[model samples]
Each structure stands twice: as structure tokens, then as C-alpha cells.
Target chain A: MTAVADAGLDLRQIEQFLYREARYADEHDYDAWEALWTDDALYWVPAGDDAADPRSQVSVIYDNRNRIATRLKQLRTGKRYSQSPPSNLRRVISNVEILGTEGSDTVVGANFVLVESRTRGMEIWAGRVTYKLRVVDGEIRLAYKKVSLVNKDQPLPTLAFLI
Target chain B: MDCVTATVPQAGTDRPDYSALIQPERVHGSLYTDPRIFAEELERIWYRTWVYVGHESEVPQPGDYVRKNIGPQDLVMTRDREGQVHLLVNRCAHRANLVCEDERGNSNSFRCPYHGWTFRNNGELLGYPYHQGYGGRGKLNLGMATVPRVESYRGFVFGSFAEDGPTLTEHLGAAAGEIDRLCRLSPEGEVELNAGWLKHRTRANWKLLAENETDGYHPQFVHGSIFSVTGSPIGALYSEKSTAVTRDLGNGHSENDLRPEFRRHGEPMRWFGTTPDRVPDYVAKMRQAYGDEAEQILVEGAPHVMIFPNLFIAEIQVFVIQPLSVDECVQHSTAVQLKGAPELNRRMISQSIGSVGPAGMLLADDTEMYERNQVGAEQLRPEWLEIRRGMHRERVDERGLRVGTATDETGMRGFWSHYKTLMEDDK
Candidate 1:
């Protein structure tokens, strides 16, 4: 990895990256989403307000490489319990802020409100998302993506999609 | 609908005469939907029993408190500086304001937001902010208000609102053996709650859930969607598996042991421990520490035990079903991690939480059935819930335990037999 002055992490680049990622997900291009992560990427959706560590608390989606692969297989499986009829979701990401840096991990924070609907009804899930990105091969790769849902402790209807 | 007309023989030293109330094949529908019945249930049943509260591990440190609801009351289970647990009513003595607003946390002391009434972790009153206003008294009203009676058995904490309620051990008779068996799986013979609970609010009466949990008949039909996905079905998921074995624990407690056919083969599919890695280091080590038969039986998931009323415990976790009202219920799920198990084994047990927690695939399926049942039962006739699957095989023994087919409604009948006793009390 080469160091450079202002690696284009300004508002435009970050905004474009998020918009492109969301568009790719909407188009069902999971390959593009997979490419955004490093080989040892970590994806975590925390169970509550605090996510200082995933080891102590319950997490909605805690994925290492192996777990991510298993989850992706389940999503595509025809018999996934919650997705028998499939669910539609739209994630609105906003209020992006750069929360300084931690060694090699560049911490970025944002707010997200995901609107999901299925045969049940519509539910609005709001949360704070933190992305720890690492610069690799002149591209930003996700080291970790953590989301703290507002109603994490509540008994939700289901999680049929990747929000 | 009042208690006057509902009066029946009281449960006594002699066997209860439920002949008029409970029939071998059917029971009066009043037991299911009546508010008068539910109120009497609160008085003579749930209050008299040793209802389980939060696990001791939830409040591990001093000044740590977690809010919980035991039957109809809200309580706070706290651990003081000496690492002793206390279950106190959440309401403040003055104006009855709840002391701890957050679900769980560690604090120096609990101070009422309305007034400045403060209390120590052990539930002792500290002092009020404006003490001089009350007759210029020094440390006036510093004594603590009455707290609920608290007790613990195998890290499971329980509270009794009434002074004369049965002791925790006495209330948990035969079920006590089940709890002890679960704790013994850990090398230290203890387990701890790792984190805050996973809570779910469902639009269904709480009693329905308590019955459904031990009723071995509903899983094949109700959880069909979950089974359709996760894995293959177990042999016990058939209608023919309805042999119900009911154990009678005196003092209003009973256990429904479903003798599903697979149990005879020493392999209950629901009881199988599916670890991410089949050859777990702990299992191997446990084989070395404790012999093969001990390892096989303990490791293999078998019996599902539900303590009478609302304390639901099984091999892996403990769930407390708190009824918010007649039409609403909230379930708190806590996963118990064995103390000396290998790290991955603990993680595997924790992963089992995924199958039961708020986002649990299996729970999502079961909840739909409960919601549908609640809504449908309200509209349909009560007899529609006729639980007479294996009515002819019931045999009452010397222990007062009833034996029947596993898939039979005998377990449910056993529960209602106790339920009828409670409902008939005040009525």
C-alpha cells in the first residue's frame, strides 16, 4: 500500500462509493459487494446500541469470511425460512462523518434507515452504521461494517434480506 | 364470570377432585379465555409458585441491575458490592415511580427521577436530597422499604411477592432435577448469562405460549416452514409420536415429558448438538474427563423441560415468558454458557441462540402460529381447541403422574388440571 496526500476520501468519493454499493445491491450484484471487502473482512450488525465488542453481546449478523459464505448460500437457497416469499428492502444512508483514524483502519460513521416490506407489513429500521475501511491496492476495502439498530432488542418480524 | 359461581374443591393434602371440572377428553372452555379465570390464576397459581427471574450472571458486578417482570409485577434483580443478588419491586415507595429506567446497567445507586429518593445496590435506602424539609430531621426516612423475597437455585433467580409463597426449592420439585442436570454439563456446575436478553413482543395471550412450549404436538405443523428449510424432520414430528408422559410436582408444578418415538432409540433430533465443527475439542476433552456414556448423553440434546407456569428451561438456554396483558406477551431469551467448556463450544452454544432469539429462524416460524392461534381462537368456538389426541391411554399412577402418548394433549391436560385448580380458587 502506498501513502498519498488526501486519498480522495472527500465527500464526493465516499458518497459515490455508498451510492454505487446500494445500487449494486438493488441490482442483486452481490459480487460487487463482495469485491468491496478485503479477504478478511468483518461484517457485523449489532444487537443493541453499543458494539464495543461483538464477543460479549448478541449480534444480528456477525460474519467472518466463512460465515459470510454460509449466509450468502442461505440467501440463495430456495428454502430459507424467512424468505419463502422473499422480501424487498430499501436502505437510505445519510449523515456520513469521518471519525478520525485508528492505525491502519480508517473509521467512517453514518446513519441509515432501512424500509423493509413483505407479506407481513412495512417496518422502518433506523440505525447508526460504522465502516472501518482499509486502503488496499489503490482502492478502499471494507475491514469491518458495524450497524447498531435502534430497536435491536425488540422482537422483530424477520430478517429476510441484507439491510 | 365472577369467582362465586366458579368455586370448586380446593387443592388439598388429598388428591384434588377435578372430576367435575376436568374431563378425561375435554375441559370447559372458560379456562382458556376468561379474565376472571386469569385473575384467579394470578392469585392462587403464579404468585404461589416459584416464578423464575433473571439469571444471577446477568448482574455479575456490584450495583448491576436488570429489570424483569414476574407474572404481573415489574421487578429489578440487582447484585450488590458483595456479589449477592436481590430481587426488589421496581416501584419507588413514594409515588411508585420505577427506579431503573434502562433495561440493564451498572450504577452506583438507584435514584428516583421524580423525587430524590436514593437506594443502594442491595436495595437499602440511602438518603433523600432535601432531608431538612421534613421536620429538620437528620437522615429522616433512611430505612429501606420492604423488598420482595429473593432466592437462587443453580444461578436461576426467583422472587415471591407474597411472604408465605413456597420456597424456591419446594416449588421446583421434579423440575429441580432438570435444572441441576443442565448445570452439571458445565465443569463448574454453573452457567452464566452472557449479555442483555433478546426480547420479542407478540400479539397473543401469554398462557397460550406457556402451553405451546411444552406441547410436543405443534412443532411438526406449526414450525413446518422452519423445518422445510433448516434441515430434515425428526421422527418425533409425526402424529404417531404423541405418547405423553406427565409428571406431577406437587405445589402447583408439573412437567410434560413427551415420549416421542425417537427417545426410545436414544436419539431425539431436537436434542442433537450440531456444532459448527463436529469434532469439538471440548467434546473430546469431556470424553477424556468424563467417560463416553456421560459425554454422549450430556452432549446429545434430549429432553425439553418447562417449569410450571412461565419458567421455560431446556438444555441450551432459559426463556421467561412475561405476560404484558391478556392480549400481549413479551419473551426474554437468555443463553447459558457452560463455565469450563472450550471457547468454540461456548460459541456453538451461543450460536444456538440464533435458533431461539428474536431473529431465530425457528422462533420466527413458531411466533406466526401463536399470533394466528390467538386471533383465530378469539373468533372460533372454544371447543375447536379440543386437545384429545391420545385420550384413551391416560393412566394415573401412585405418584399422581399421568402417562399417555407423546403427541397427545396429555401434557396440556396436565397443565390445565393445575390451571383449573388456580382458576377455581377465588371463583
Candidate 2:
């Protein structure tokens, strides 16, 4: 996209950050995962259609900074049965593009396919992720992230793991 | 293609004796596992009973419609040009394909993709292409079939496939009071379900979700993780000390009533711990609409009631359980938006997302129990589920509804007795 050229950000740096972020999430490294977010982080997974506003329409998961902390805290307790005996997870992140830039943040988009295996069965999850990356103290942080699942509107199983 | 079919040997040629299977103190475990029993319930309970379809608020305007399911039968709930709500069986009149494919949309009519058979939103046949091939449309013995009766009580729509049976109001009986409580909390005396549903698929019998909806006993144990984190005051309501009671609101409906505990506090919004300043407009509007009774309305808040086979008013959300197979079901939840309270509605929506749904902090644990129960149901050694928690102490209230303590199995026993009646009756 022309926005990538206009943004003048290092594409290789962005890709490395995304790969590291994916690793932290797949491995359930809560500390590393939470550290990657900026203080004003907004993590969202919209339900039904992608365009439904969070302020109006319900979401599968919509967490501000405090909610993000609470979610990780719940998982840390080791009793969130949905993830008690956590499922084995591996996610492939690809199709990375620096969509554009706003203020000090760079907007990037990517496609992901995640395979989650548990005692019940295996589930194949695919979606598109939009991320707003910001640089603070020379370290890249996730300011905002929204996941638009292909099957967002359908009745789905437990998604306690980080998407 | 050649298909090989096999017949399995079973005991009784007739239906299983529901009276023996669903005893007063215990129920046979196979009711949760037997495919035959599930098939029977699909007819007697799902199709015959007045099952919740969708809210009238969901289709307020003409051309608005939403797709729903009762048992496995697909339906389209639509508002016609005359503003009458109709429940149309989604099959095409000509080829049996779904007439409306989208989950929801605005369309005056539905056109079938297979054979170009069109249907008005109200289930009337519009016309078909190449009509000369089949004698004119007047003689074709097919049209989109609508449920015989569709009725609404305060905007909650329910449909029964059987033409003549108990009126929706009769089926609701005293249970409608619970729905009224939820709506009366709204300043405008109405509730809107505009928030799109976040459906959570559960690998368990649909009855499990239904029973668990009002089982106040399980929350302290099933959702202990949430209590440990939030130190929720609401958790105290289910304890032995609290005065909250569970009711067998006749006709299979039941409730985990928290009013006694909340009213004891004599404060408003104690259900969710909000201050008056947070929802001043709502409080004021409610006071204006309800007069002096607003104090009790604010104190009691919304209800935690589940209506018979399908609908559950889960406090602030409209929850529906759609059964797919005997061991699989989906719980659809949409946050209820009050008609005139924007401030309270926003907070309720966020709270609904955090508490329920598939990934919710609280419900995920409950879902785990539901799935585990399914796995346990297959065991052969223990054939009965003991659900007579409060039978010894339960009492009939002034309204004739049986009542038990908060942490009793009164809700489940009530549910099963009602189920047995419907399953065993020929009518």
C-alpha cells in the first residue's frame, strides 16, 4: 500500500515486532504479552459484523487497559476453567501491511490462522487483525488492536485464549 | 449411491415411561443422553410449547426481520407492510431452500435462489418463474408455512407451531411478572435488544443450560474464580446467610430471586454497585414514570428469570438456548438496552460483555461445567441425578408457587416435574 511508503517506518522492524507479539500470545507469556501494550491500550474483538460500533453493538471481547489487566489476572489465577488446562495454541501471522499513520502511531493490518487443540477437540480460527503501533521510549507498543473474525457472527466455542 | 442402514436393538417399543424416568427426587441420567428422548422433546416441548422467537423490538419497523430456530426448524420473524409480525417457516414453497439466507436484513420479500419462488415477508406466495410448467400458482398445494399462533406479552414474542393450545399469556402465567420487572426498571417501561447477540456454543445438552440458568447453588462453586478476583458483593446473595429465595414459578419457569436481599439493603443499583449520580437521569425518569414505587424498582433492579423451555432473562441480557443435537446447544446472549436510559444502558452493555458470553470471565467457567456434565452423563454406574435439594423444606407460597432457599435444587425439581408432564401427556 502507498501508505507504507508515506509512513517511512521500517517494515522489517514492524514484522519482527509482530512475530514476537504472536509468540508471546501463543505461548501464554502473560508478562511479555501485557508489557507490549501502551497504557492507553484498547483491545477489541467485535461480534456479529466487523462494522458494528462497540459503543452500540456488543462485542465478543472489548477491553480497555484496566480490563486487559483484569483478563490477564484471571488467567494468572490458574482457575479460569475455560483455560484451566490451557489449550495448546499456535498462530500464523502473515499479510502484514503498514496501512497508514496517525499522529505518533502507525496502523498495520495482517491475516492470521490460529489452531487451538484441547482435550475436547481441535478448532481452526482465522481472522484479520488491525493494529495501531506506537513508539514510546524507543520501544514499539500496541496502542490499539481490533480483530475481525471470519465467523464472528456465528455461534462459536470458548475463546479464552488471546486472539 | 447405495447406502447401508443398520438397526440397533433397544428395550421398550413404546416411549420410555417418563413418570418412572423423571421421579420427584431423582431423574434418569439417560434423559440427557438418549437420542430418542431428545427427539420426543423436540416435538412436545419445542414445537408445541410457546417458545420465545424474538423480541418485537428486534423488528420495530416494516421490512425488518431476524432468523431464529425452534428445535431444528428454521424460521424468519418479519414485520410486514401492515406492521404485523409474522413467523414464516424459512423453506421455499417450491424447492425447500431457505427463503431468507441472511441472519438479518431489511427486505419486503424473500426470493428463493433454487427455483425463483418468491414470498412476501408475511408468508404469502408472490409468484414463481416459468409458472406455465406447473398448473397456475392457485392450485399448487404449497406456500411458506407460518406458525399457527404468534403472540407478544410486553414485546416478548413467542410462537407455537400447534394452532390451538394455551394462549401465550396462559403459558406465561405468573412468570410474566418477572418479565414485567425487567421492563419496569426501564424509564419508558420497555427494553430494546439492539445489541447483536454473542452466541456461545456449548457441547452439552440444552437442558443443562436451562437448568443451570436458575440454579443459584452453582454460582459460588462454578464461578469461584470470578468471585476470587472481583470480590463481588453479588456472590453473597447465594450464600446460606442471605435471604434470597428460589421459586418454582409454575409451568416450568423458575427464578433465582435476589429481591429479598437487595430490598433488605434498601439502596438502589445494589445489584451491580452503581451510585445514583452515575444514572441520575434514569433514576429521575424512572421516578417520574413509576411515582413513589420507583424506590423499590430501583432497589430490586432487573430480574434473573428463565421462562420454560428457551428464554432466560439473565438480569440485563436476553438469553436464549437453541438446541442443535442432544449433546450440543448454543447460548445466544444480547445485552438489553433500556428504552430511555442511555447512561445506564452503556454501562449495562459493557457489564454484560464482561460477565457472560463464550469468552466472558464468569460464563466460561459455567460452560466448562456444562461440557463436563455431558461427559459424565455417559457413565453407567450411577443412573439417577439427585436434584431434590430442598424438597424437605420447600413450601408453597401464597401464589401457589413452590419456594426454596437460594442454594436449593428447587429450580431443577420444578423443571423436571414440568418436563415429565409435557413429555408424558398425549395432548
Candidate 3:
């Protein structure tokens, strides 16, 4: 395949992966969501506006694969009262920006708006998504999925759902 | 002016008839819902108290500035060119417009966005756009009014609104020991706030959080699922098997030390590293930096303590609760990292942050409970949020406030007693 077609194919595959992940999250199919990541994958939801790094400042959620599994396990075991009713979430990923790559990882960016419906009501969150993806056995795996929320600085209710 | 002056009450003196406003354990709903009482609190308590402005690290460099709101007043906490920190009123002396719009940044001086009137970082009079038009009335008329007094305890900075109130140290009182304890844990004896904070709004009264900080009785029940998920029982954290202990530390300070016994006692391998989950490498790093003993000491802090009214400092983290309206409050949770500590310690700080932040499982439960309380209180019944845990113990010592356990309600009683004193003081 030509390089252009190859890039197009890779982007399409990544989009499909994100769509699948969102479906699993909304449906609470955390097992499928777990499969989308490399064993060493990182999922970060930045707390503040300029949260480029979680090492220094507070992050909304900074979970490695293990921590994520723990969180999912906790949520599934009916032990997390915060998830008593279970938050219903729907995520829309658009405005795909292919910001090129840096050493072994394909850097792709997109805009995501997540709508979470709880017993209270629906909360809409918009943010920029930066994905660092690497191909493992011809399947794209998430190295890092960094979400910089638009209302990061604004006081938020408990952000139970992942963006 | 005399009537208005008379209305401004003194604390713990000529006490107003606040018996109707507050009870021994519970306060009237008007304390949270009434705008008039809220205004009185703004004028009498929040304004007079030594409120935390910001950290020195927030404005580490000269010209670095951060904006804060104390009660209804807007303030600009800035570092001057000479490295002196100043908490100046954001209102321009001329037209009362805010001088800075951005929350934080490095600025040599502040220029009113509405007009081009500029003031130095130290709130000194600077040139105006119409300087020639103002003629000789520049320095004499335009000198910036400073915020009465600004002081620093360790690296934590605070501002006082009144010119006659007690010094920041005096206002801090027994609470200073807790801050010092947190600072002393670090070998360098200094702590710096990490970059930005997690600012989020809650649909509940601000005082609810202040009460919750010192409230030990609610955690196990409110955070039932979180406790269950963590696998370790609450009985482990408290020394006493009591539900929770709230202790009056005297001088408006209190400790709601959740007793280790309240948690599942003696859960072996309780260290963050030993958990089945992927241990954050930062946790191991923190353990190494402090050595085994230091690590143990660090983990032993009484989980929740509030420094009256707005400042709630727990577990090396500081959260400022600002009342936005009767039904809502905005909380700013700033992550504090021990200066000169190992990088892993800072990372562990972040890991610990995950449990209490706006998105943390613990806070999520707390916030949900608070909303429920707020909604429940709207019915105007005789219902009271029970804070009567550990009422039997009356002993007090150098720990200042003594608690039955971490889950006792002594903290609430301490907070309410002070609240009543402040509300009733007919000074």
C-alpha cells in the first residue's frame, strides 16, 4: 500500500478502536476496554487546564493498566457506592488531528465530548484528546491517551466516568 | 454608621442570641440557606479570620501573581520585583475595577483592563494613560490600598481582611501545630504547592465540606463501597474501634482522627506497594526517601482535619472552600509536594491525590452524600446530620484535640462551637 493509503488506513483503524472503546465504556464492558490497551498502557485524565504532565500537578485520573483494572474491578464488585447506579456515558470523538509521530509512536489528536447521564442528570464534558499509539502485532495499542478537559479549572462534581 | 457598627458582632463576647441559630451538635438550616446569614458570615467570620491566600510557590518568581476571593472580596496575591509577596485588593482605587483578569501569571505590574491605570506588583502607584490629565494628583490620590496585612507560615501564605484582627499566627492558633507537623515530616521543613489545582463546583453548602473534613462518622457509611473495594476494613486505621472521634483542640480548632481500629485492624502488608494492583513506583520511592520508620509515620496522619471555615488541610493536601451561592460551593484542591523530597515522593503524592481529588473515589462518595444532605435539609424538618460520635470522652492533651477514633464526631462539635462563638460574639 502507498504511504498515503497506509496512513489513511491506520487512522481509520484507530478511529474504529476508539469507537469500540467508547461503546464498551458506555455499555460498561470494561473487559473489551482493557483489551484495547498494551499491558504497559497509560490512561490519564488531566485535572487542570495545562496538565501536560501528571508527575508535577494533580491529575483527574492517572491510571496504568493495573490501576485501571483495579478501578474496574472495584466498580464491578458492587463495592463502589459512587457507582451504585452506574454512570451512563456516551462519548463522541471528532475533529481528528494527525499531529505526526515521534519515535515508534504515532501521535494522533482528536476532540472528544463525553455526555454522562447519572441518576442526577446528564453532564457534558468537552476536551482535546492526544493519543500516543504503537502497533503491536499489526494491532494498534494505546501507549498514552491524554485528555485535557475544557472545564478542568472549574469546580466539578465527582467525575466518575473516564473521558 | 453606628447601627451598622453595632450590628457587627464580636466573637465570644456580648454573645448574640445564637441559641436559636445553632444547637449543641446541629445548626439551623438558615446557616446554610439564608443569604442574610451568609452575608453576616462573610463580614463577621470569613473576613476577620486569617484565610489562606495562596502558597509562596504559586508566585515563586518576581511578578508571578495569583488571584483569590476571600468572602466577597477579590484579591490579587502577587510577588513583587524585590521578591516580597503582597496580597492586595484587586479593585482599582479609582473606579473599583479588577486589576487582573487571568487567574495566574508573571506580570511586572497590573494594569486595569477597563482603563489603562497601572499599579506595581507591590501595589505602588504607577503611571496612568491620562497621567498628564491627572496632573499632580497621581501619587497623592492613586496610591494603592494594601490588604491590611499579609503573612507567611512556612511556605503557606494567608491574608487578613481586617486591620485590627489578631495576627495570622494568633488566628492559626492550635491549627499551626498541624501545619508544622506536615512540614516537619519533610526533612527540609518546607512544602511547595504543585503547579495548578483541581477546581470544581459542588451543589452543596461550603460549610458541609468544612464539617465533613472533621466528620469521621460518615466515611465508612458514606464511603461504604470505597471501603469495600479497597478490601481493607476501616477498623485498621483507627486505634480505637469506635466509629469515629471528634475532638475539640480548643481555640476553634478540632481533630476528627479516624481511629485505625475503625478500619480492618492489622491488615498485613497495608503499604501501597504490597497491594495486588500495580503499585505506583512513586510509592516505593517515597518509602525509600523516608526510610521504613518515616514511611510509617507519614501514613499515620488523622485523615481529615479542617482549620475552621474555609481552609481544609488533610494529608499534605490543602483545599479552600469558597461559597459560590446558597446551594453551591467551589472547592480548590491544591496538591502539595514536600520540597527537597525525592521525585518518587511527589509521584506518590499524585497517586494519593487520585483517591481524594474531584475524580477520586473517596471524594465522589463524599460529594454525593453532601448533595443528598443538602437536598434532604431543604424539607425544613427537625432532622439533624448526626455528629454525636465519641461524645463520652472528655480528655484532652498536647495532641491538643483528643479523639476516640478517626470516625468520631468531635470535629463537628468543635466546628459548631466555634461557629456559634463567631456568630454570637456581640463585639
DockQ of all models, two decimals each: 0.22, 0.75, 0.49
Candidate 3 ranges beyond 4 A from true positions? A1-8, A49-51, A101-105, A134-140, B1-17, B137-140, B143-145, B232-235, B238-245, B257-304, B398-402
Which lDDT value does model 1 have at B413? 68
True lDDT of residue B106, candidate 2 = 94
Model 2, residue A67: what's the lDDT? 90
Question: How many residue pairs of model 2 clash at the backbone?
Answer: 0
Ranked by lDDT, the better of candidates 2 and 3 is: 2
* Native-to-model Cα distance after best TM-score fit, residue B415 in candidate 1, in Å: 1.8
Q: In CAPRI terms, where does candidate 3 land?
A: acceptable
Tens-place lDDT digits, model 1, residues B1-427: 2232333334563433445446656654435455655665577666665677878878888888887777768778888888888877777766788787888899868889989788886767777777677655344555334345788888888777667656778777767877776765665667777655667666677777777766666666655544554554442444463443544444434455543333554542234434425635655555555675554444344346667778876546567888766666777775567677756344644465456654565565566666666666565344335657666766776766665555656667667666665545642
TM-score of 3: 0.85
- Candidate 3 lDDT, tens digit per residue, B209-280? 888877665666766666666665442444345544556665566765543432333332242223413434
Error of 3 at B170 (Å): 2.3
Which numbered prediction scores highest in DockQ against the true structure?
2
Residue A86, model 2: Cα distance from true site in angstroms = 0.9
Q: Of 1 and 2, which scores higher on lDDT?
A: 2
Give the TM-score (vs. native) of candidate 1: 0.78
For model 2, state the Cα shift of residue B103 in Å.
1.3
- TM-score of predicted chain A against the true chain A, for each candidate: 0.84, 0.94, 0.87
